[model samples]
Structure formats: C-alpha cells, structure tokens
Target: MNVLIITAHPEADSFNSYLAAKAARVFEKQGSVVNSVNLYSENFEPVEGKIFYPDRQDSVRFDALREQRHHWEKKILPDDVSRHIQLLINSDLLLLHFPFWWFGMPAILKGWMDRVFVYGGIYDSRQRHENGVMKGKRALLSVTAGAPENACGYNGRHGDMRLMLWSPIHALHYIGYSMLEPYLIHGVRGGLDGIAKKEQQKLLDEKVEDFENRLTNIHEWPIIPFNREDDFNEDKTLKPEAPEYSPFVRHDPDGWKKS
Candidate 1:
C-alpha cells in the first residue's frame, strides 16, 4: 500500500514531528511504500492567492472555488498544488500529523487544506460527499495536545474530543476518505520542567509504543462512521430512516427517525 504522511509542525524537534517520523518507520516496516511531506521543511505556502494564477478567471474578485475549477480545466494550476494533489491521488492511506492548537489544527495545516483540496480538480458539486473522486482512499489523524486526556472527555473543560474533530472529520468525509479513528497523544506539555526527567521519558516511551502498535495494525483500524450518500435526502437533510453517525449532524440520538 502507498502511504503518504503529511506533517505540519514548525519545529523539527516538536512532538508532532516525532510522531510523523515514527509512523513512517512503522508503515515501512509493514512493507508499505511511504512518502512524507513536511510542510514546514518544504516551505509550503498555505495561503491561497491570485498570485498563484497567472491567468485569472476573475481579475477583480478572487473566487477560490471558481478559480480552482477554471485553472484545473485550463491546466494552469499552481505547480505546488498540482504536485500535492497528485501525491494525494496516488496514496492509499494518508496520515495527517499536527498539533492541536486553539481547539483546531495549526494555520499552516489549515492552509494546506484550503489550497490542496482544490475544487474542480479533486471534486465538483456532483462529485463530492460519498461520490467524491478519492472515495476509496483512507485517512487517519495523529494529533498532539497539551492538555491531559481527561480534560478532553465529555465533561472536561476542553469539551468532547470527538466534537472538536467534527469539522475536519466531516470535511475529509466530504472529500471521500474513509476517515479512520484519530490517534491522539495528550499531556504533551512543552518539556519535562515540572515533572522529573525519568517520568517524562517514561511517558514519552508509552506514547511511542502506542503509536507503533497502531501503525502496525493500521489495516484493522476502524473507520469513523460518517454519513453516506444514502443518508441524505434530495434536499440534503438526513433521510428519515438514516442512522446517526455524529452528534453534530443528529443532535438527538433518535433524531434521524424524525427527519
């Protein structure tokens, strides 16, 4: 299998970076072909701009979707975006490694999504959701958090971790990835200042071992039960009989039956 790991972390020594490297090694050991894209190291431009298009479809107003489609049809998409898109197209499994910042992904990672998941080329109005171009591919997220794991639980001050992940998870689903259960490593505080060095090392080792196990058994990973094509009605609302996949979509567990 072809595995692509995209890492978004500013510091090379950051925990997120370490997880990306470790995951690549694990995948390779399993006889999977691995390709890693380090956003920071590659100096990838996360922001979308008119400068990327030499021939503008709309010179005055910068419509991202319209331009994305236009450029793709014209075969004038930016070199970087085209290259990244090709990588995504070829990969069977995609691993996203990043730090959870302010309850979401870092800016660069968000930027990568904005620019790389291009419209027209990757998906169109009728080609998204369950029918997305990359429908058969799978994706997994590896996120590092500074807070303790309990803090992200249902009653924790940080709110439910699944709720925090809804947006990105849904976006990946829309783009046709079988979103795998995310791998999270919490309590990744900057350094071992407050705790003893030995304890810190022990904690790090435990997390690394967990990651190794997950990578070794990636094919057995459960994909998130996202809504499917049949789940929606003609108006785009949930079908009356469709099962609920997320709290964000079906506020009440039994709400789908009432639709």
Candidate 2:
C-alpha cells in the first residue's frame, strides 16, 4: 500500500508535525510506501487567479492557462500542489495532519486543495459519473486542536468538530473515497505537559496501530456514510451505519435536511 501524508503545520517542531512523522514511520514500518508533503514548508500558493474567467472560452487563452496550470501541477516547487495530487493518485491511503486554526484547516492546506483539486482532476461535474477518479481510496484526518472535546460539541463552546471538518470530508466523498473516523488530539496547547505529552503519544501510538489494522481489514470496516451511492442506484438498498448525514444536502424525504 502507498500512503500520502500532507502536513499543514508551519512550524517544524509543532506536535502536528510530530504526529505526521510518526504516521509516516508507522506506515513505512507496515510496509506501505509513504510520501510526505509539507504545505507551508513548500511555500505553496493557494490562489487561483485569472485562470478562471467568466466569458472567456477561447481555446488559445484556455490553452495558455492550461499550460500554466500544467506547470503549477507538474513542476516540483517547494510547495507545488500537483506533486501532492500525483501522490494522491498513486496512493491507497491519505493522511492529513494539521493544527486546527479557527475550527478549520490552515490556509495553506486549503490553498493546496484549491489549486490541486482542479476542474479536471478531483472534480469535473460533466465527466464525473458514478465512480470518480479517486474511487476506492481512503483518507484519515489527524488534527490537533486548541479546544477540549467538551468545547467542540454541538451545544458546547467550540461547536461540533464535524461541522468544522465537513469540507474535506465531503470533497473526498464526492470524488469516491472512503473516510476513516478522524483521530483528534484536542487541546494541543493545554494538553502538552510532560505527563500529558507522554499520554498523548501513547494514545496516538495505539490509534496508529488501529489505523494499520483497519487498513489491513478495510472490507470489514464500516463503509463511509454520504457517499455517491445514488449514482449507483444503491440509495434505497444501502443504509448508513452512522446516523450522520451530509450537511450539503438540500432536501430529504425525512426531516433530516439541513435548514
């Protein structure tokens, strides 16, 4: 198995970086090829400029932009988004490690997604049918947050972590990948004392083992909810093991629609 690890922490010494390294090592030890990409370290540009224009369907201009896009996607820059996409294409498992910034991923990681997951790559509504290009791949999120679990609940202070993490989860699902339950290390700033760090490392080690076990037995694990089963006409036949539904859905026969 090939695993891609995308690390979004700006600081080299951050706990998020540590977990990413640990994940890479564990995956390597398990005999999986590991590819590590650090967004901030690569100085990746997150903006999509005039490449997306309103009334410009000219082939010449389009081709020019496409060439530029190809360069950005293919050239190995310190932070090229294409390199990560290539890794994603070749890998079986994707691990995203980041320090939660304001209840979401860092801007650099978001930028990487914006530039890399382009129209013809991860998403293309016109060409995408039932199974997307990324079908059958798996993703795991390992986030370090400054808030406690109690602060990250629905009625609690921080709101639901799922709410904060829905974008990437939905993006991956839309492209036909399965998602593993995220492993979160909450209160990173508050929970990193001597003993706490040791406990956290132990817990992370156990979770790493669990991650490996689940990969080895992926068919036995529960299927990810809210995938594009409708395209396969399996909506009626399939039932979600988890009660969670997609927040992006606009309508539902039941009263579960998000208002």
Candidate 3:
C-alpha cells in the first residue's frame, strides 16, 4: 500500500507531529511506502491568486478557474502544486493530521487544498464527485482539538463535530476519495500543570497505540456514506428513490427541508 501522510501544524514538536511520526512508523512497519509532508515546514502558500499563472488568458482581468485550466493544459502548473497532485494520484491512502483550530483547518492547509486541487487538473464538472479521478483511493482525517470530547459532541458547547467536519469530508468525496471515519482526539491541550501531567502522558501513549491499531486494520474500516451522481436529479437535488445520507443533500418531498 502507498500512503501519503500530510500534517498541517506550525509547531515542530506538536502532538499532531508526534502522531504523524507514529503514523509513519506504523505504515513503514506494515511495509507500506510512505510519503510524508509538513505544510508549515514546506512554506506552502495558502492564498490562490494570479501569481500561479505567468501567461494568463486575459492579463487585465484575472479568472482563477480560467488560468488554472490554462496553465494545466499548457503543463505549466506550479511545481509544488503538480508534485502534490501527483502524490495524491500515486497514493492509495491519505492520512491527514492537523489541529482543529477556529472550528476548521488552518488557513495554510486550506490554501494547500486550493492550490493542489487545481480547478482544471483535479476535478471538472463531469469528473467530480463519484466520477473523480481518485475514485478508488481512501482518505482519513485525524483531528486534534483542545476542547473536551463532551463539549464537541452534538449540541455541545463546541458545536457538533460531525457538522463541523462535513466540509472536509465532502471535499474529499467530491474529489473521489472514500473517506473513513475520522479519528478525533479531543482535549489535546489538557492542562500542563503537575496534577494533569501523568494522566496526559498516559492518554498520549494510548492514543498513539490506538492510531496504529486503527491503521493496522484499515482495510476492515467502512467508508463514509455518500450519494452517487445517479442519486441526484437533473436539478441537483437528491432523488426520492435514493437513500438519503447526509443532511447536506437529502430528499425533502414536502419542500420544507429538515434541519
């Protein structure tokens, strides 16, 4: 198995980094070829703009999609973007590690997605969703958050994690990856004072082992449910005949959508 592990954390000695390293060891032990990258360390640019396109369709007015497609067809995409896209194409599984900051991924990683998942190169209207180029590949997100697990649950103080993480899941799904159940480690920033020190250490060890064991049995894990292209109508609404999965896209026969 080929694995691509990406961690988006600024701190080199962060728990996310530790977990990423552990993930590498696990994959290596299982004889899987691993390609690891750190977004912050790479100095990855997060904003998408005209700089990527040296030769634009219309120099006066910039169109991101147009330039992306143009550069892609001309085979002049930025080296970093091309390389990352190639990694996605070559790998069978993707292991994403990051801290849940401001209720979503850090801007740097989000920018990485913006650049790497080029509009014209990675997905087009016909090639997206079920028909994406990465149709058979798998992706798993391991998120670490400072909030306690209880506070992050449905109707909790931190809001429902499921809803919060839906965007990333759908993004990967849109790109044709079969997403696995996310591995969420809550209370990552538990107090560092004396009384909590030993417990934190124990929890850290346990989580590392858990992450490894989960990957060891990765094949047995079920993929997250998503409606296929056929499941939607010409209007892009879910067909009544299809089984509804996400609240994001559901069949509302009465026209009054349920929240």
Off by over 4 Å in 2: 51-79, 126-130, 190-222, 227-244, 250-259
TM-score per candidate: 0.93, 0.73, 0.95
Model 1 lDDT tens row, 174-246: 8888899998888887556645657666887898998899789877988888777788888878887888777
lDDT of 2 by residue, 1-259 (tens): 9889899998988878987887787768778898998878877677765444333445455543454444444553233455667788999988889888887888887777766776655666543423677777888788888777788877677778867798877666666677776777766664467888887778656756765566566447564466344522345433434343554442345644333
**CA lDDT, every model vs. true structure:** 0.86, 0.69, 0.88
RMSD of each: 2.7, 5.7, 1.9
Candidate 1: lDDT over CA atoms? Answer: 0.86
Q: Least accurate stretch of 10 residues (summed lDDT) in model 3?
A: 250-259
Highest TM-score against the true fold, candidate:
3
Q: What's model 3's overall lDDT? A: 0.88
